[model samples]
Target: MAPRHHEAIIVGAGFAGIGAAIQLKRMGIEDFVILEREDDLGGTWYVNHYPGLAVDVPTTTYSYFFEPNPNWSRLFSTGTEIKQYADDVADKYDVRRHIRFNTDVEGAHWDEEAALWRVALGGGQQLSTRFLFTATGFLSQPHTPDIPGIGDFEGTVVHTTDWADDFVADGRRIAIIGTGATAVQLIPELARTAADLTVYQRTPIWVVPKVDLKFGPRIRTLFDRIPLTQRAVRAVTDAIYAFMVDTAVLKHRYFRRFNIAAADLAKLHRFASIRDPELRRKLTPDYDFGCKRPTFSNSYYRTFTKPHVHLQADGIERVEPDGIVNADGSKTVIDTLVLATGFDLWEANFPAIEVIGREGRNLGKWWRETRFQAYQGVSMPYFPNYLSLASPYAFLGLNFFNTMEYQMHLMDRLFGEVRRRNATTFEVTEQANARYLDRMTEALGDSLFTLGNCASARSYYFNPAGEATLLRPMTTRRAVTEASQFPLSDYTFA
Candidate 1:
């Protein structure tokens, strides 16, 4: 057994990790360690450095409840600005002291006899903790496409997540693979600098106008002076977005109207800006609006109008000696290639870790064939004194941080009860978890996400049995209400 110990151990230093640490402090749980794989605290923001990368969500709703940025420069800050925000949050909360940078949590196993988690790190570092919190995000792992001859290509290749600083695209032909969210943001920025840019498209995404703007001096002063003004504004914005999604899409007969409006806007935007009819059709999305992710951008359509930028709709056949080859036997030679393929949102990410609960069964073995199942998206049946923030099916509609606040309150009350009752652990019943998973599957079947209009053939939302196990069908408000109050009777405390 390798040697450090603490009351609690968090596996990441991102929003979820830091947030959990803050919650622990408030609960009077002082002994904790936060382990981050990278040498920084921003998590996903710290890694992805492609040009023009920014938050599609408005700034007003993305901030934490404890701190709000009164002087946000833009409605949607760029990647660098967002990274700076993460740093500021760390500094403000004094959370840096609790973090161990460049240390990866290699594996974690439960010591059944001791009723503690045995955490292991790379290079033989080990620790035992009463509770384990996994803040490792769902989207951090980049899904590198298994294309033929990708490794054989002679050109400079990079992923959008790990962009090199010294890499220059000036006066050189650059090939960009996958026209997903990252590609939409980076394409416009590359079009301005690269001598020639070729974007290989697998499928077109539904593009929406981004209502982005800088906060004026007046608004900043109002937030700084009134203080509560910013909070009120954030609350209102969150409510509006929540209501709009619920009334229009969640359970509505008029949901198709919203889709029609979005489609019409895309058509109008495509025809008005792009002159080539052939290019227009290639850019037009065949999938239903909101079926897949809806990208928001102002310049994505206009970028295609530039003479230096080209979009290849034909599927990529293989990577040639220097560049990408199309299915029609056409080849485009370029100096550099970038893959923005996306992330691995598979359900087996956690099960890949060897976590043994109270019983002798390994978590990986239990979830080997089935998808991930959790009660209220936070608790597993066998795992006691353990919780996961932003777990599968728990991603909030408006702000994830807001949902986290609710979860923190719930855990605080549960732990308080544990202390009061002189209990060592709290474990959910297997029947409850099974029931929740059944409801989750039934709800997703009727939701817009399960519709066959997604751009990709395969989805990250389902299991091998085609059950929707990764997403929650409940509204943000309802989820918080149900999860905020943890019932003691549901678990067998010891």
Candidate 2:
């Protein structure tokens, strides 16, 4: 029997995938299916249920423009609230009806002769589609460090993304590894309940105070009643974040002093908990502020002041059933081990599903050889009718909603072009891809995120080729504007 098919198959139900499905419906393209590995609709939010899990940006500007939520409990919504918003949006748009949850895409093969994407699903299921979109986010896959003898540990082991519900840390010794964004949030939560906590840090990170506030009933009522008032607040919040964090601290040269000054303030923030001068120095990062992803937390620093907390700067040597051994030969016994090591980056974190393109070529082969280049991060060469959300040098500013919305507009234009040409395939020309990357490379050389102290920090922005290819490297406005425009001649149709 022939397998089921659809006009398009979207491999995610997160913000990007949901946006694609909605836009497809809006464009009068109804025959589409969304494949989600998880049972729930929310992608990252669905997987991650750790304590103190919240978005870094303010909720006012952090959500979808098409469907804004005025009743956010806090300026920075918690993971629970974000997941609820995603669910609400899905319900409002009738998106869940088209979604196949628990359906993992094992692989994708492009049939050049048939002009269709043949995707392999688990349980020997197969489906074909005219187009395929991957929205698997970078941070969706939790990364556990490779410590020798890790399996020998008898205690409960957990990652922030896969936290066990019934595992209580109260009256238990807990040791957490890694100090990235997840650890910064999880440390404070564990410190409150655990009898003793030992944190294993590979490197130092700079942290600033989080600006979070609860919206009172009166404020929420005003926002709900006067929609324009909510819009005004969102605009103001977007402008502040765009200028203060992206433009002033990370992008523009003239305002770089703000970055340096902010680092000094972080040092002061650490001094509040760490009174010892040497310990304070240990907390300060040796590299520049923006080298690695900056975190916002008020409790992270203060949690260290607890008498039972131990911060280990040394690396891990091995793990035993009874305890963890440090590089310095010191051992600490714990009841639970939480891996806050963050995710494998960019190319390393690419979707595990196999993707075969033109002439029987696969995405892993082409992308590995070229080191992740594409036309505006959406369309790739030789990959006809294929588009993705988080591609090399295609990601825009901090606001993820804005980034997805910008890409959706670009996708609309490309799909329209396909309709106009009456073509089954649309792949970027090699010359066009090179030209775009050439100009992008030159622009990236000037950005502090790339040309500055990021090299010393071993940031995920840099790919396996030792090039910073994850970021778009342009101002948010310019990047989004450029993403929308495409010379039809740049793509070849058949």
Candidate 3:
């Protein structure tokens, strides 16, 4: 069949994808298309509609650096508000027209002869492009635990990523599994309405108290009228968070007091909120805060104080027809079962859409047989003219917006190199990819993820080899600078 073609093809219309498109337009490259699997613009936000769903990061730091939202209703935005921001940005930049919604990519193969990516779409459609950018985020894929009787759960089962607007839980006996970020955000909301809410937590997580406030009209008016004033607030917020990440989360030594203090604060909050000593112990994390993803919630600890809410530490052994069997043989009848269990981070590397690199180098096979590593966490050694955003070890701390910015900077540079050389293809050399991974691996060996009291957090942060793979192991500032200084000579373009 004759296939459609473009100068550039991007997958996933989230922050990474939208940023890449905007940058490409700015560089006078408009022959591009953004393919989104969902029928909407927002990527993660559009998918998740769970109760109490809101961004953990502050609005000041979460927004795009170029398009700061001076009109955020709250300090941290709800999922609905955040999704609207994404839609607004797309409309403002006129990138929405380039987006083909509900177009799912099934596979992508690098065409050596044509120097183009042969992208196979769902429903027997196909496209070819000179450059293929995969912005399919790491957290897009949902993961339910491998429990024996989960399928036979005769009650209402809901995954956080697939929550429906019409699904109701009020006055129902709810059993929610997992105590990660998603679960943490959900418990407080469920406690308020559910007849009885039992949270089956396998592992406890460290929690920092969240301080949220409404952005009053006075501040909103000032921010919208005077852009510089809002810029100052955002800058100050950025500086404060950057320091917290560098001193506390990044390093395992040297004023390790910061990590300890943060943990102590969490413990104190738990102590103050939870009256029962045994219950507090069950809620406390044995590992350090930064081992797993650190979570912020003002009402999470306070929720347990309610008589309607229950916390189970032994976790769910199996699911009965209408109840969850705890490891200790206790069973709680649940009318509704919600799996707030988050996404499959590792599986995201394989791409729901398959990718075949040069010389029949299958992307999935390479990741499984060899380790998952990328040159500066963007380009692989074998994938010419391909850029993978939000790649392994690419997440800079917890600030996704900043991480995407750093990645886009690298992408902008690589696109520039492609234009300058008038090259048909570009990929990182094997040696360069290896060397960059080696340095990062060494530095990661000493970070809080490996050490710092997190021996058995069972965190998604570590891969099967017990090495940290999800985080970049550097401060946000440094990660951006490193991406900016990428040696153009490192890539082979021809």
Candidate 4:
């Protein structure tokens, strides 16, 4: 049978895919399909429903600039609320009709002669399109630690991504691995109900106080009535976070004082919450601030003060059917083993799926063999008419919406040019990509990951090659301006 065809094929139906769809529609490109692996939309928000799940970033700055949700229940909205927001956006924008749930894209390749991309789906189906956009989020793939006995004696083993609805933690002894952002949220909730809770800490995270506030009916009504009021609030929150990212992470060498202040704030929060000095020391992060992603929570530190809760800094020696054995020959017997170990960002999730471009250049293989790069964090050299939303140097600030907004601007500019030229295909030139890569490299030289003491930080920011390519080293303002004003000659449209 002949392959189905469209003007564009979008992989993943998350916020990135949704934003891309909205942009395409604005460009008058309506014949596109969003292929989602899950049965529902919301991507990460849909996949993860673990306990204590909420946005660490404030809700005001976490949403699309144009589609602000004035009805957010709290400053840090719950995962369920975020998912609902995504659904509402889709419905409002009329993008839900373009989405195909439970459609898995296994691979895709460029057909040079045909001047189209042939996407291979599971179950041997194929789809062709003029453009392909992979919006599979950075943290889509979960990582399970390769412990020796994890597979054998696991009793009700659950990863955060695949949490079962009926799984109960009440009075059950639990051992959870990883102390990342997700674990920080989950540990406090489990401590409340578990008979015994042990957190296996591979690396301690920097956590500050979360000033989350519940919005009353009055505020919601005001926001709905006067949208500018909500925009003002968003602007304030955005400025504060932007300052933190610009000073602490991007310009660490010159603005080291801001990083020190942030570390002091976290330390003060820890000191006030945890009573035991030893436990406080154990929980303290050794690396510099902004090395890894930081989270905010009011209950996480205090949860450790509970008598039944234990923090095991000793590495995992192995796992037995009954419990986990510590490196110092200690054992913790538990009924439920939770793996909060975060996503596999570098190895498995760079491309997420197979992508073959011009001259048989494999996206994953090329990135691994050389370095991870993309022109303006969207376009690649050999990948014609393709955009990767989760590419390196794409993430701008603490808030992902900032990145998305800028990328949307980029798409608008790029697609506008294509429409102006009446071009059917577009590819970023190799020279332009190289120049952008060099500029990114030079800009990142001033970042905390490069200058600060991040050797001890097992940060996902640094890839296997020891380069911190995760974040773009620029202010959000600059990112937006560049996205809108990039040279048209950088991409060859034909």
> Which is the leading candidate under lDDT?
4
Question: Residue by residue across 405-481, what tens digits does model 2's lDDT show?
Answer: 77878888888888998898888898998998897787665566654666566677677777777777666676667
> What C-alpha lDDT, on a 0 to 100 scale, does residue 336 get in candidate 4?
93
Question: lDDT order of candidates, best first?
Answer: 4, 3, 2, 1
> For each candidate, what TM-score against the reference?
0.94, 0.97, 0.97, 0.99
TM-score of 2: 0.97
Model 1 steric clash pairs: 424-494
Q: Which number leads on TM-score?
A: 4
Q: What tens digits encode model 4's per-residue C-alpha lDDT throughout 391-439?
A: 9999888878888899999999999998899998999999999999999
| Residues forming the 10-long window of minimal summed lDDT in candidate 3 | 344-353
RMSD in order of candidates: 2.2, 1.5, 1.3, 0.8
Q: Model 4 segments beyond 4 Å from truth? A: none
Instruction: List clashing residue pairs in candidate 2.
Output: none
Candidate 1 deviant stretches above 4 angstroms: 252-254, 347-352, 455-459, 462-465
Model 4's number of clashes is 1
Task: Please identify model 3 stretches exceeding 4 Å from their true place.
Answer: none
Q: By lDDT, is 2 or 4 better?
A: 4
